[model samples]
Target: MLSGAALSRFRKNLMGWFAEYQRDLPWRRTRDPYRVWLSEIMLQQTRVAAAIPYYERFLERFPGVEALARAPQEEVLRLWAGLGYYSRARNLAEAAQEIVAKHNGVFPSEPADALALPGIGAYTAAAILSIVYQKKLAVLDGNVARVIARLYAVRGDLRANGTWQKLQATAGHLLAGRSPGDWNQAMMELGATLCTPRSPQCLLCPVSEFCEARKQGLTDLIPVKRSKRSTVELTLASLVLLDPRGQTLLLAPPAPARKSAAANDVHTLVSRMWHFPSVAVLQGQAAEALRKFAEESLFRGRGFRLEFFALKKVRHAVTFRAITIFPFRARVAKLPRVSASKAFPLADLSTVAVSNLTRKVARAALALN
Candidate 1:
């Protein structure tokens, strides 16, 4: 419970430190609500360095809400290829379309309006309203959560609803009225750079003097995390079905189950990009199973010579599945029309939204070709 001159001192110290030490990210260069909103959405569940290229590419393509609204979903997904969490891309496009229709192509300045946008939650809404619109809203993200938990030496599981309420109240109390945007960014910057999860640089922290966890010599242990669940390993045989001309097949992922809407839709992963026909390997020999699945699913009973040219193995980590992908490539002498349409020339692999595992397979296949 920070109060009086102590709270003021804390805010001053944090903001001053942020002004000097904050990283000069591209997203921080603009005060445009649309740009800020896009960056915030992209950065969710994504690293800053990784998000930069995607952000730049997306902005270059869409430029504004109207452009984003009009752009095709496939193009948006292609731009968001390497960045996981495909639903963000989908929802962002939907939200953009809605903004264009409802708000005259302008992002709403109010937090509640921003919150109404698809995939825009409390943190995102606060961030956009504060930073872009300069609204007096407090933004609480993972970084702020860690910062608050450590500062107050909060001992409860952070996932608990009560803990979140407490954290929100604490964050709201600490926000400075004049520069709420700077204050919010400052807190996030501090947590990202100095108050890190594993080995926090307490000596360099701006508000070290006020941090209860540091004073109590519990900086490492203050923000307790919920226990992690075990991951399920899945073996996937990814067929890199390439025609003689070098095109690949791709399928749209099926809609997610009602209960697991947040989880990655495997159907979308395959459907969104051009890749060799693939199948899940439940049991039996890998090569035989892959060939049989391709014949039935991809070839569709068409008679085309199956040439097993290259086999490459790649591993990818999804939220719940540790997937091992085995990529197999074969070139047919009489390239079927079906293969020709589905296949992409081995040279233009970057144009598609293939998964990292499939990308690895493509690289290997290209080298072999």
Candidate 2:
């Protein structure tokens, strides 16, 4: 904890550094709560450089809370297709509708009302309220938490409930200066650019003098890492069927449960989105499992024989799962009349809302053709 004089000097140094060095982000140009809210949601689990383009494109489409509230959920998901974390887009649209119905489309100024919205938790509520409403609340996101952990030399599982509450308290105490918004961003910026988890640039840090972890030469060890989940390797066999018209068959959400013995192997890699017919396979059973799956679910009563050729494999990782996808392509004489699937032109896939995993399978299949 910083003393009165020390805290004052620390705030002055941090704010000065921020004023001179803060990157010009698109969200910083406006105080609109909707825009700030979009940036906050997009930046969660996404890099700044990656989120900027999505943020601009989303704003261009929706424009405001009313527009987003009025838009279909599918359209919202379509705009957020490549951003990943589809739930964020869903919640953004839902929250917008809530604001329209319950709050007349104006973002809530009260912290409680903001927190009541979907996907708006403590950190998000604090961030938006402080930045847009000047509510004087402290934002304790991952970046801010890491920065606080180093500043106070806090060591332990930072995710532990007790430790997290203490850190939140400390963050609130350190909230100084007239601009809580700028102050919060400065702390997060310092953590992102200088106080990184690996090889932190202590030499360039403006608040290094106040960082107890740096003073003790334990900056690297402070903010102890959480235990990592063991990676589970999974293999999925996907079939991409194309008609003579060059239209590809894509399955809709909630794919039928695999009746194969490998049913338990199925994972939630792809959510409720358009995707190729895919099934998890045990080692050395890719061909057999997919054949049975196609026969049972995709090709049943469709009057088309399933003759498919293997395409290049695509490897992807989602959180703890390392997935290797076996893509197979087949040309059909005509489109199948399956209720669970739809045919889309292979040339233009951007019109549909799909996951990155689906796109990977499409790209791998396309690369060979």
Candidate 3:
């Protein structure tokens, strides 16, 4: 805990650093709540460089809360396709609708009110209130938390409830400037750029003198992270069926579940998007398992005969799961009468929304032709 005078000095030094070194991000350009909300949501679990283009494009399509509320779910999902986390896009659209109905298309200024909206957590609420409303509130995100932990040498389980409270209280204590938004961003920026998780740049840090971790030679160990779960490796086998006319088969979402447990699991992963019918299977029996899956779920007594040949393997990962997708190219003589599969020209994949894994499957299948 810094004394009042020491805290004041810290704030002045941090603010000075921010003035000289803060990167120009689009979200920093305006105090508009909508743009701030959009950028914040897009930045979740995504890097700044990756989120910028998507942020610009999303705003261009849905300029305001009313526009986002009126846009179809598919259209929003299409724009957010390659962004990975589909749940964030869904919540963004849902929150827009809630704002239009509940707040009359205006963003809430109060942190409490802002938190009531879907997907708006404490950090987001604080950021919005401080940045947009200029409230003297502190922001405690991952970066800020790490910075705070190191500055105070706050060890032990940070995920513990009491530990987090201490961190938040300390953050509030240090937020001394008149412009809380700039101060909060400055702390986070320092963490992101200088106090990185691995090999922090303490020499260039503006407030290194105050960092207990640096003084104690424990910068790398101050902010303890929660242990990750064991990685699960899976072998996914997918059938790339093409009709005699040569359009590749793709199943639309809400596709009925298959009997195979492996296929059902993969189907759940992509419950709301289009993809080739795929199943996780034993490496030794991948071809036979996919053939059985295609016959039962994809063909469905439509007299469509699947003649498939196994393609090269495509590797991909989703968080803790590492997957190697084995694609099999098949020729179909007839179309399914009861299946949800639709044939699309391989050249027109960009026109529709799909997962990154599905794109890899498409690429692997196309290479065969």
Best by TM-score: 2
Query: What lDDT score belongs to each candidate, Candidate 1 first?
Result: 0.78, 0.86, 0.82
> Residue 125, candidate 2: how far off, in angstroms?
0.7
Clashes of 3: 0
Q: What is the lDDT of residue 231 in candidate 2?
A: 87
TM-score of each: 0.92, 0.95, 0.92
- For model 2, how big is the CA root-mean-square deviation? 2.8
lDDT tens readout by residue for model 1, 109-168 = 876777888999999888888897778889888899999999988987886978898899
The parts of candidate 1 lying over 4 Å away from their true place are 252-273, 334-341
Q: What number of clashing residue pairs does each candidate have, in the order they appear? A: 11, 0, 0
Candidate 3 lDDT for residue 174: 89
Clashing residue pairs for model 2: none
Off by over 4 Å in 3: 244-246, 255-264, 302-304, 333-335
Cα lDDT of model 2 overall? 0.86
Error of 3 at 333 (Å): 4.4
